[model samples]
Target: MTCFLIPTVFQAGSLSLIMGCTPNASHSPVFLLRGFSGASVSSSLLFLLFLAVYLMTVVGNMTLVLLISRDPRLHTPMYYLLRGLSVIDMGLSTVILPQLLAHLVSNSPAISASRCLAQFFFFYAFGVTDTLVVSVMAVDRYVAICDPLHYHSVMSRQVCARLLAMSWSVSVVHTMLHVGLLLPLNWAGDAEGNVNLPHFFCDHRPLLRASCSDIHSNELAIFMEGGFLMLGPCTLIVLSYVRIGATIARLPSAAGRRRAVSTCGSHLTMVGFFYGTIIWVYFQPPSQNSQDQDMVAAVMYTAITPLANPLVYSLRNKDVKRALRRLIGCGAVDS
Candidate 1:
């Protein structure tokens, strides 16, 4: 959101000096409150924090991918869904982190028009894919619970692959629609001045606000696409989980039922955190105090969620840890 015009200060021997190109020409520049007041802190501190988060997120997701790939025993519907989630986590982190880190340190952070559009495309696409993955996971659990007899056949590898493919394909279509719509819009500045946006990245809402023309079509498209991607899947997940809970409760042995529910507790917790934060941020009406609040929630889904994923899935999963140990050539059995 912070529109800083970066100037090619000077290029020396394999080094360059860059300066924040303030408005020197006739046009007056608009200053947007890009993000939280990290302007108060030293740039080094911000960079370090972002770096640490990025490293942890990447490592966690990579570990999950590695574990799934190495251990053939983990070739199941659940782990497949988990690996898909890992892919999205890695992709989403890559989309946001590097630019954010650069912006944190650089006095004048500037991204090219093409890069900005590309960022939005990937970010939204991955977000939609992640939502679908969570829904698939919910259905996986439902199959394991409500239809145990045909769980394997019902949620076979082929079906899972097709579902994963659908998620990615739908997300691509969704992102293309928005990006194509943006291409025709006159994002260029007028004779008066450059635009002011109040977010860190080129988020759709802020970018649309900066546009000179009406964005009703864009807004409607966003609402329709977002609603279809989120609400439909979310409803399915909730319903599947509800039936799963009922099926668990009807079990004869209390301990068995408890253990069965425990298998999904972590995933259910994750889903709750994901959908709760997202709904609170997007579905509700905006308020004057919503900017900072929304940023914190955004950090949950963007930064913290991916970082916490491996922890959540691993800590609560005996099978994953067992598989990891085996993959590492540690003892196959845990004491």
Candidate 2:
């Protein structure tokens, strides 16, 4: 076994260097990302396709936000939470997609260590925001459906504001904790001071894998702390749905029960797909995980889910459809 360890330690803002096992790893300031196997051959096609996706994600989410904001009928707690979700979706896509587009067209996939960690920070931050906002939406839905008489009082403006504030602040601090843990570890790179990150984006797991220092504690933190953060919201979502199901079950009208089931089914399907991909990406054993597999799963949440959210939560909504139709009618009458 070959080992290299040195006691020399250096610290800079959000970075620390401590030489450890692996060739010249501590000296590296940049990491080469392995974007895709065929990037060179079909980069243009992939870029065009993804650019279209990014554009649609932006336009769709923005339209939903505007629609909800403008329509007085859509000013309830659910729509408010949905608007928050759209804004966060746009943010999540913006943080990941544009950087990814630049890397796709560039000759070298080199990303500076600082830039790489920055991506890591924003990606997880927005992801946690997504989770929290969805959980808040679930709470809104629970109150509206399960206890409609007092829904307004229960989920008032002040309460909603606080929930949203907690969601954003907690998400930022959660991501900061993860990034701070990673800051002290030195990266492993080759003769050219380049660590080859397997995934396109700077996800935390890949960055941790590229580290030269021992990551036992980091892994422990991820599994224990990260798991709690993710799992807690997921449990909230599930319980909300379970209560919704029970409430619907008591509906004396057969048709009413079916209609409720249809609506909730669609919602659960979309949420399930969104969160299932997250679980697949994050909770797997290291030995069983591969970069390619992670990349595929990543596309579902990072790309597909954001794009689909407007359709799932907004376009299908009868209130939104009525609002859109009314706007179109107004435009037609004006012309």
Candidate 3:
């Protein structure tokens, strides 16, 4: 509890500092290519890799968004959640890709302190937003499968809109709370700025470690925000799935039950991967010190999963597949 409690105060103060209020930069050395242990990487290879992933993530998510929007068949609560997820994927990737590309190509790959904070701000913002969006999806599915008659009214258009709005608002408040407090910590000036992040983007723990001053505020903010953000939505997802499972279990026919389970299973897999990697990365102590391990987790959430969302939700889904076939009007979509 103390671990969770302390960070809340730090986040509160940090948020106060980030409202166009500049803090003096600490003397953290700008490492252009530190090593795999730190975020150091060769300009050419990293940029190429980032470019490929960026294209895939954008194209995949955008395609899903388009398919859902254009098709009348997809005008349901579940597809709406997928659409929200696609938008978040687009946003989260865009927020990080440009700066990452700049850092990889430029000889002096350095982000200004303020810009770094801004990157972390939106990174966490949209990431949290995506998590909540998926949680909403779980609830939608639960209602749809568990209580069919009420599903229409319960997850109606207005209700869906409000949920999406609330999710975005909550994400903004939480991200701003942590990132804003993070801006004030003196990083460059202090000698403790040796911590290097492995990934391309600026993230909370990595940026916090780069601070050269007292990290009491930084550590506290990390613990509180990380705990609340990860736990809150995760709990909601679990609860929704549990009820959904119970409902599926009650299906009269075995085939019906199997179909219901399969439909929900893809979404559940996505939820687990997204939440699992993110929680492990942010919540665990760094002493696990697995740079390789950490990078893998980062790739799962940031790169791989975004690419997989369309495939995971749309490809396997009967409704989506049918809509896509109608939209493309081809013999069949490429395997």
Candidate 4:
């Protein structure tokens, strides 16, 4: 992988002048991304493994999207939101995996500054989209389980559309702030004149850590805005599930309780899986051992979680299975 560096003395001098820090003289247009180092596994093998996972992630999420669209049975608000989630999953994986794979094969793996910013923008956009969509899905489950009679009225097609739009808008604005703030800053390299990004992808933390500029404001934005964006949706999701659990407990029939639990099981699993890794990665205090930990957590949320979402939903959901079978049957009949 490619990496870049700036001297601390140069950084200090540039910081003194601020706008006087010339990009052409101090910074290379390309930044080196140090991918997994000291790996027991070979790069070729790593490449193959990541490639297979990427393909599976794309195909699985795309299949989920198509299945939800074509199947009339899945035309409900829940599935509509699910289709949106599937699209986000596909986008998230596509944003990182292709460039990552390309870097893995290259003798000199590096990305231009412009490309890095674009990658950072889309990565966080989809990530925030995932959080909001999950929160919305939790709300959908709460209505369906706790307030069944009002479900159709509350979660109308128009409402679903609005919610989806709102999710995208929020994500766009949040990422815009992040990228907007990052654009003007000067990044200084380490003592060796290199900016070393420990993790695989272009994450916010590594970039922040590597910068020579005064990052107090940037750090503040990450803590304040980033915290709310992540924590708010998580709080809503938790509250919705808590209410769902109470409602399930009050059901008169055992079968009713079973049905309610079954309806929410897939979503709960996904929420746990996605949020658990994220919290572990971002919320924890950084340490000497944190680099490897961060890389592993990054892989989980970016690659593994997206791949597993479709599996969890499809395998647990009989409706999706039936739809898939019917689709295959129709295709076979046409042949």
Candidate 5:
């Protein structure tokens, strides 16, 4: 991705200031993304893998969303949250993978600074949205099992809409604040006008490393603010499951316990897979973080999760399978 680090004359505030109001003799209008450009691994091989993943992601999420929308039986709180999750998955993958796939093949792939910044904004926004939806899904499960009699009243249509609105609002505010923090960095660090991002996408971590000004402040924001965004929902999921476990344990029979766990099994698997990749990329200290591994693991959520959502959340669901069968007029076929 290419970022124009050409020194802009200071105007005290706004975009000029955000672009690092400074004087530079030379104008560098492009940032060359060196994403796997120097690696010995076969670029074609990697391209095919990512392309397949992206295709599956697009097809799978689209199918899930359509299946949910067309099926009257899926008009419930859980499926509502699931539709949101699928949409975010599509957004997240779109923001990262297409550009990454391009860079993997080209000798000197580049992106405009504005596009890069936009990518950065959506990446975090969708990521935050994903976590919030996952947490909410956990709560939906908790209510469904622990208080089945009151589930509908508790997770009513209005309540689910409000939850979705709150999640997007929180995510947008969080993304805007951080993107603002990153804007002033283009001209801060380098005397040579070199402000290229090292990662495949305009990942904030690499952007922070590229900036030499107020590094501590940026880390603090990521750890304190971003951590709250990440961990707070996680804490909710953990507590919800703890209660769910307790409720399942009190069941009278082994069959009952199995049934209860089965209800949560798919959601729990998704939570683990999603958060496992997240922690792999985010939890480590910057000094010890490996970008290579981070790039690979990012595929899990960006592409793999979306690709798997149909199977995990919908295809395996008997109701959804029945709906799919009916959609295609194959009622006699086994799901």
Candidate 6:
């Protein structure tokens, strides 16, 4: 293996030399991304479709945030958490989609190592925020349904703010831990020397696959830490829902039960969609055939989910629909 030392500057104002194992090859500080190579669709069409979806995701999430903020009726704990979820969805899509759009248009789809690291950091942070926010929403729902009398006292404005703060803090720390583990590893390739990543985004698994470094410890840490980040919230959500189900079942009137179920229906749908895709992407065993599946799954959680969330909440939620109508009517009157 011929080693070439290439000096590069990270965003942190530090200069480091990266070692490449390819013989007589040009030393490029950029990492080439293999984005949706197996797609039968043309890149131009794909780009346009995704661009539309991204626009919709941003606009929809922003509208949801505004609706929650403007409407006094939605000033409850549930809507507060939903607004946070919208923020996270918007952030997650923004971080991933612009880079993806650039890659789709460019003939050479590559990113600098520093840029890749930054993307990875923001992507994971937003994703963890999404998960934690959803989990918090579940708990909020549980408190509202299971302990209705004390819900206000338990999830007060101050308490809700603190919970949101805690979720963001945990997300930042979780992303930092992953990025810290990834930073020290070398990206030298194998004997045949392929360094291009298979996925569009700078995900941990694909980056690890491209590296020639010993990732045993890294993998272990990912399994433990990543599992906690993924499963812990999911378990909480499931438990909360189960308790909610029991409470709903115990309700005296069928109308009351229906109301309770409807209250959580939108959130349940989102959690199912988000975690279902996420679980398939991360937990499934890696295989040659599964590459396309993984990419599709990643797209679902990153792009499709964000776009769908506002639609789900807005359509299923009568309060939100009424609030939207009132807001639009007020705007029209002003105009």
Of the candidates shown, which would achieve the greatest TM-score relative to the real structure? 4
TM-score of each: 0.84, 0.86, 0.81, 0.88, 0.84, 0.87
Candidate lDDT scores, in order, read 0.70, 0.73, 0.68, 0.77, 0.72, 0.77
Model 6 worst lDDT window (10 residues): 1-10
Off by over 4 Å in 6: 1-28, 189-194, 279-288, 332-335
Q: lDDT tens string, model 6, 96-129?
A: 9999999998887888778899999998888878
lDDT of 3 by residue, 199-317 (tens): 56666544544455566665565566667766777678789888988888788999999888886877887776666555555456546654454455556666666777777877678
Over all chains combined, what TM-score does candidate 3 have? 0.81
Q: How displaced is residue 66 in candidate 5, in Å?
A: 0.8
Angstrom error at residue 268, model 1: 0.9
lDDT of 4 by residue, 1-335 (tens): 00001111112222233323334323434567885756788888989999999999999999999888888888999999999999999898999988888878887667767888899999988888888888999999999998899999999989999999999999899889989888876665545444556667787766766565666666667666776677788789989999999999989999999999999899999888777665555455545355565577678878998998999998999888888998898862111
Candidate 2 residue runs with Cα over 4 Å from true position? 1-23, 38-41, 258-266, 278-289, 332-335
User: How well does candidate 1 score on lDDT at residue 215?
Assistant: 56
User: Ten residues in a row with the worst lDDT in model 5?
Assistant: 1-10
Minimal lDDT window, size 10, model 3: 1-10
Q: How accurate is candidate 4 locally (lDDT)?
A: 0.77
**Considering lDDT, which of the candidate structures 2 and 4 is the better prediction for this target?**
4
Ordering by lDDT: 4, 6, 2, 5, 1, 3
> How do the residues 1-335 of candidate 2 rate in per-residue lDDT, one tens digit apiece?
00000000100111223346665556336887775745455888888888999999999898889778888887877778778888889988888889888888898978898888888888887888888888787777777778879989999878888899998899889789878888887776677777788888887656765677876667666666766777778789989999998999899999988777655554566687687665655456646635555576667777889998887766467777777787677852111
Candidate 5, RMSD to the unseen true structure: 7.0
Better-scoring candidate (lDDT), 1 or 4: 4
| Candidate with better lDDT, 5 vs 6 | 6
